[model samples]
Target: AKWREPKLDGRITEDLTINELEQYWNPLLFIDNILSETKETQWLMAQRNETGEVYLLERRRIKGVFLETLELNDFPLDVQDLTITVTSERPESEVDIIPDQNEMSAINVQTFVDQQEWKLHEHVEITKRIMKQEYSSSMKSHACLSVTCRAARRPGYFYWNVFLIMFMISSLSFATFAVSPDKAELRLRLSFTLILTSVTFKYVITQSLPKISYLTYMDKYVLMSLAILCIISVWHAIVTLLDPEHIATKYSKPANLFDLYGLQQHKSFLPPDTAVKSTNNTQNETDNFFKEHASLDNGFADNLLAFFLGSEQMEEADQSAESKTSTDNGNLSTSVGDQQNTTVPRLSNECSLDNKMACEEWKRVQIVEQHVFTSFVIIYVIAHAVFIFWLYFDASRRRREMRQKDKDYRDFLRRHQQWQQQSLRQRDMHAILRSSLHT
Candidate 1:
């Protein structure tokens, strides 16, 4: 007769043994979606020790697939729950499914396996359930054991592949804003190309996921990026279509004055747009002023000759000849006041046109370009700062959660050790009491 040991701690019932009641013993255990199976007849040893106790041990390996429900809302940062179920094919009367409590968190991950992309989360949980047979005619319930495993996907790889790509495309779009508005055609082409590239990137990212009904966080992010890029593209078109004449009129500043005479302390502040016109106008005025009154005064004649003929000797000779002519004419300026009133004002008015406002139109264009570029830079910087802040805090929160989980696991292990130590002490005490009672 085969006898079972009582469930009392420290009770010494040494006559327990298993007699080979039958030649073969089989247990019907079923694993769903098994990939491979092997059947080998192995010798089972039931050793009898001096105390008449028997021990039996067995080992086997079976590979199977467990379908899991994946929640990919956060994607690369998402966590998944995997379940492994073991059940007997026969009804409860024939066999009962039992859970091995000691095997909790006993998932054997190979040391050489690539764990970079995925890692175990916390530990495994074991549970038992009665699987009701609703449609079958037998109406028998099978006992089932389930093991729940949690795993988290590593996000660094996807950060480089997906999020990094999106960031680069966004930065490229921002770069287009700095492009000179004068190159309207080129700017438009660049904007269009960037928009197309964003679309292509979105397509590539989506290809990695299934055609699910709901959008994941990655989907929302990609959409937001595309929308921002589209806005930038529209702004590009706006800049391209800006009216040149209107911009010139609106942004052009007062023209700078060119002083050929030391009277006004000639400041050469001419703008870029009016440089050519101012140069031509100044040359013409100098020529006309000298031609009309070349014989007015010896000093003035010398200065004029010097201005035109780049020679000190020629100017001196001209000054001497003019002085002799004035003496011969006997009209050596009746009054200084008359010379000033008749020559200075008329020459000033005739020779000088408004040299300050030469290239008002082109200057305005430049002003508009600077304003647009500045505004774009401000917007880009603000948006970039916000994006970086969000990502930084998000990563920090995830790290905190991971740390909390580790701490909790450590506490659980500490409590389990305490419980095990207490049970061991109780067992030792009970054995001592029973041994004394038997003596």
Candidate 2:
């Protein structure tokens, strides 16, 4: 039941009482501002007295959806202000939509039905506003009661429903970085799966919200998360290109001497063992010839001098003598074979050195890969920390606003209830007096 305090005129007596002969009274009501109306509402009571002072009561069940401009910049942590405006259908000259101060106070936290998605921030606020007439060019001002209900979204619910899934998808994508870049097909497949999972989650989140032109905080967060997944894919692609040779022997022994020696051109440093053996034999033959020819020199002193400081012809004569002696003695061949056997160990040592160098190079490559992974891990951690911290503070700010509004709403409810009880008692007393007079 609603009550309206009517204005009384000075010409009429304030103490005038209604006779028992008149049992009922009806007063005209002019309420044209309500935009969303329900059919369950009906006029039940209208009582009046001689001074034209009227007391009215009506039973109404109002239920309808109101259109509100939602600001989604903050998204999940955003606070929203919803309003229901009641304006007068008539011009200000004819009627004014006066707000009942006492009635407004009666509204409390309990007035708003408990909802899962949003929490009431404060008590409902009522304000009187003057709106211009819509059609007429001569702007006529009409009074309206703007009722504001401030509320905030419960972010925890959204975090679990949407963000939890997104986080999981991003994590799966990051794991792909650990996979060897050599497996390009496998890596690409996993990355695509993770990316698609993120995209699916994005679609789900968007479906829950109204279509809007601007990006919300949730939208930005989701897109950024997907970007992180894409970055992992990109990182792997780069790693693959950087170490293409590594893939061929990814599963082989960590120390690949053959690959290392091949890349460094170890063959260029030494000729074939067969060529080395033939050259060594030729040099030994020339040395023997020089000794034989020296014995036939002008004298021992002359031979020594010629051997130490001789003309180019002295070596040529030595080589010619050696070739002639080799044709005469078959035992010279046995000496050449002995020298070849002695050089075999040196060839084996060179190969061992090459193997050692190759192993060291392989170790260096592994260290480089470790460093790359470590750097990426650090970047990933820092990125997540910043992202999470920002969201935490934003959600906290929304919660603080909601708490303040809720406090105000509770206060309003208490004041309103007290006024309503007092009004009811006064009305009961007035009714008793009228019944006594009639008897």
Cα lDDT computed for each candidate against the true fold: 0.57, 0.57
lDDT of 1 by residue, 270-350 (tens): 333443345555454544554444446555544433333323236554655565663632343332223333443333333
| Candidate 2 lDDT, 274-342, residue by residue in tens | 223344443454355444443342232222222222233246434544554634334443433343344
Q: For every model in order, what is the number of clashing pairs?
A: 3, 5
Q: How far in Å is the alpha carbon of 312 misplaced in model 2?
A: 33
Best by TM-score: 2
Tell me the TM-score of each prediction against the true structure.
0.58, 0.60
Cα deviation of 346, candidate 2, in Å:
14
